[model samples]
Target: MSRAPLLHASPDQIAAAARRVMARCDELARVTATSGRIERVYLSPEHARVNRLAAEWMRELGMRTWQDAAGNQVGRLEPAGSSRIDQRAGGHRGPALLLGSHLDTVLDAGRYDGIVGVLMALEIVRLLRMPDAASERWTSGLPFAIEIVAFSDEEGTRFGKALLGSSAVAGTWEPAWWDLTDADGTTLHRAFLEFGLDPGRIGEAARRPDEIVAYLEAHIEQGPELDRAAEPLAVVSSIASARRFQLVVEGEARHAGGTPYDMRRDALLGASEAALAVERICAAEHHIIGTVGRFEAFPGAVNVIPGEVRFSLDLRGEFDGERDRVWGSLSQELDAIMGRRGLRWRSREVHAAPAVFCAPLLQDVLRAGITQTLPSRREEPPVIFSRAGHDGMALGAIADVGMLFLRNPDGVSHHPDEAVSAGDVAHGIRALAESVLHLAAEPAR
Candidate 1:
């Protein structure tokens, strides 16, 4: 007649579990491409190794595990002991709620970029499977199924295209991408074959909108905001829109001894000024960032004035219109600077991605999870925008998506120096676990 009270893990147990996740992250980091450093890219041997390890762990938790056509490691847990593969009329089984992040790493990556998210998802599943945590309100089993996916490619460091793994699952993969080549001259198609995957079957990875109840990802903040606020966890509002370009400045080469400073048309000087202009313009606008991350001069001779210079521009903002607006203004400044310096310049668009906003309903669910898990905190959890791209950007196409960000004490990522305290990871795990429980109790939307 009455509902049984919900069970929650103690703070001490949550902290110990968090340490396990962190230690597992370090263990997986060891399975990388390079011997001493982390460089596990898409479809590489190290990628395969990590997937195998994750699959084994998934099976240990009573979930069926398999590798999807897109090279993602997938694990599915049906409601407790029920064996129905799909839901039947008047049955308790339902569409799954997805939780996970990519396992692939960038060059010399830290132990907890994407790795921590997948581990946290696994921990959530572990909590769900425990007898004490299970709820009896659903009659036979939990209302919805639980699925964990460790995407194979999110960094795109090998193929120069991000979200390949998620795109496939979202049914947004482009056939033309198969022809893309890596630095080693291997085509994506060829690499797929080498990795024992059939590229032609990638479409099979796609899931219909109804197949998933929702998607949630746990990731590091990858910025200083959370660290500065002294908070261990936060909710993501939206991922920033980003555009990249290559700029080339052309000018006549001249001898350093013969050319006067005022008379010489130096491409390097023009490019350098353009880079400064980008910073100055972006600084004027809030939440806009423009970075000239790469630059090079032709001939590179100390005695000769540069004939040509190439540089990269990466612009990002909280909204698409704002990002584009900043780019337009920055371009005009670059045009004026090049013209005044008597140099010709051109820019080629390399990549572009629109921002993805988290679903408001899911945001409320995660917020409740954070609140219930960290009742000691007086203020509401900080909602921040992600300046970096993630697999969620692609997953957003097929399902409503939300994100939880853990604090990075050093605010560093993609390097060995990147770090997250075990205490924070414990908070992340508890929050994620609570989020799942909260979602399980809700009616299907």
Candidate 2:
């Protein structure tokens, strides 16, 4: 006798809705890529256009949706029996579910990184609002409400400050956080104000205590594990811990020809050696993941030895202890490389987030739903780690959070070539609907 998401929704209706969503992903991929990082999103201009479009579409969904001072778009679903917005969310008396993801992509992002969740939420509401015939005669009076958000920042591709929007809602945003700046001296607070968002209203974005009983976010599994497992949709049990840092290597600039191997201290060469050592150290310690994704070398002359080099180091794992251990090994390798190469090296920690564990109740519901949607895919569920981060990480600080990941086959994201199978996209939609229904049906407080 539990109220649930409208499980009565027919397969045909589900398919149609999913198809529409998949198509939108394709469309947005094109549109979002154009703005190309307007605010540090992989495609700035595209991110802006997509954000505006999402807000417009949310309004069209018959829900009063608006953007907050932090630029996080918001939409509300009132209780079935009520016509007015409930102002008692902080009291945690009312029941509601939150669903969403980011709109920004990494530099040269593909179509499906954070955009899928926004599209899925829109479709779910679309089906729920349709009349029986159009809605496939499905309805649920589960006293449930859904809150959709397209978080403005997650990748921190612009100013290297990821997960800003989600962190703001979790009551963690601060002036110091806003003080962060990018390479060009673009302050985060200034960026917010320039975009017409207010830093002063940051407190208004905080979600109330237990106001949201459940949070579900859908995203592409940005890893090779799922692809290797032959599974697409994964009910994430936990998110791996991550530590990011930038290493700066300094050496004397001199004529490449003049700086003979016997006397030269090539900073770029030292940094490259350190990068491999970092990867090797991870392998030596166990299953740690490491990447030296960004690197820049100074002194452009073809014959000149580079004077300085900087690179980004990202290390992640299924547990925190392992992450820390890998960091220690990386430090050792960096020091060893600098000493042996006679180069000066230094590093600074950029960000840190612990692994997140999913709610057992909700995870089981998700696993069941994935099995039902694609029977063969049940035990074959995708078990993977998110290389790229999301706002869900910030939400983890305040409450239990879970994510449903669809297949990212080219296994690529945050790039122009990222793609998800239409069939896999359908599986994702079915899984979300099923999970939502099951969770809503339960009378758990």
Candidate 3:
């Protein structure tokens, strides 16, 4: 009957708790809102004050946190001193190991978006209650049953409902999105019963299959792949397949003093060479992507000539039949670049989703915790491809999902000077406190 072992979280104490969760997420990115296209935050009121300071930093780290009533934001961590040696090592389960992310952002986010996976799940429960690297079989035992959600709107930015609370904890929030509407039309069932909740209990916010088995997320490769491989740590493997659209071009407006540029058929000059051939065919495919973000023109005039223009593309990849053959070759190369400039087109889909792969046994425990917690930098484990998007894609529709990427040292995210480095987010939270202690103390079944 000897015990006194469970210790983990050094990498300079998860880089000083990831610089105190990036200075309390830069004081919630200088007070929340800034604009929306899935930004600033949703389910507003500064997303319930960043879900009440992520349930008060998981009850100031003694664990046992909360917020659900569909505001999500959980925070557990009870192994009761390693529950009878992880239930005699069968891994006594009761639905656990669920570290989450996404606490509303986008209009002007970035204090480590999704607030660095809720402060790396409260610094992996203060590195398993501090002993510092107990693995050759943790006897001071805490063999999994840890949690730390914080979801509540991934980035619908405000009721657009993108993975909002991982689609109500994977119940897939689709009661026709409760008569959704916005742009000041407001509706997510009258904004979740005007924020008190219970639009017929919206499927009672799912998550009950015992309570959740495994879901890890630690975002921000938000783009620029660790500043193009100056590497701060990434281990995502996948999560790409996307699609979005909206293309309208029409033509003929005349009268910038009676149109003259070659007798004008301009629709914003055929939407500038079909938005630069959809960014050169998304860099000619291979981890493909094609963005246009947004565009518009119509009689938006300083004299008028652009009858119409409207634009958008946002393609993606990592297969879904090569993201539907690069969304049908970027709509047949923007309809042959707007039919050789005759201009008259229209496309629309607005959304499509698919792609999420991580979990080769927790990416070999986050590449052996970045080679035993960062060995002077040639740590190799780099494969970034999550071109921004996740709640680990609705907890990869239940079970086996993983992600961890932190290297956005000013690369940009949603906005407000989106930065990330205080030593590359405390070295990606000491490689996510060694992937939450080797996938939450494995061996329990």
Most accurate candidate by TM-score: 1
- Model 3 error, position 284 (Å): 24
Worst 10 residues of 3 by lDDT: 1-10
The best candidate by lDDT is 1
Query: What ranking emerges by lDDT with the best candidate at the front?
Result: 1, 2, 3
lDDT of 3 at 314: 74
| lDDT per residue as tens, model 3, 135-236 | 322233555567778887777755555776777777777677777787898888787777777778666667754566678778777777678767777788
Estimate candidate 2's alpha-carbon lDDT, on a 0 to 1 scale: 0.74
| lDDT by residue (tens digit), candidate 2, 122-196 | 887676665542321125554667778888888887777778888878888867777888667878777777776
| Model 1 lDDT tens row, 1-445 | 1122233567777777798898999899899878889889999999999999999988777667888899999888776555546433112255788999999988989989999999999888776566443442222246777889999999988998889999998999999899989999999999999999998888888988888888999999899999999888999999888898998999989998998988899999899999999989999998999999889998799999999999999899999999999988987998899889999999998778889999997787788888877788788899999998889899899999999999998699988989998988888888877777777777767
Score candidate 3 by lDDT: 0.71
**Candidates 1 and 2, the one with greater TM-score:** 1
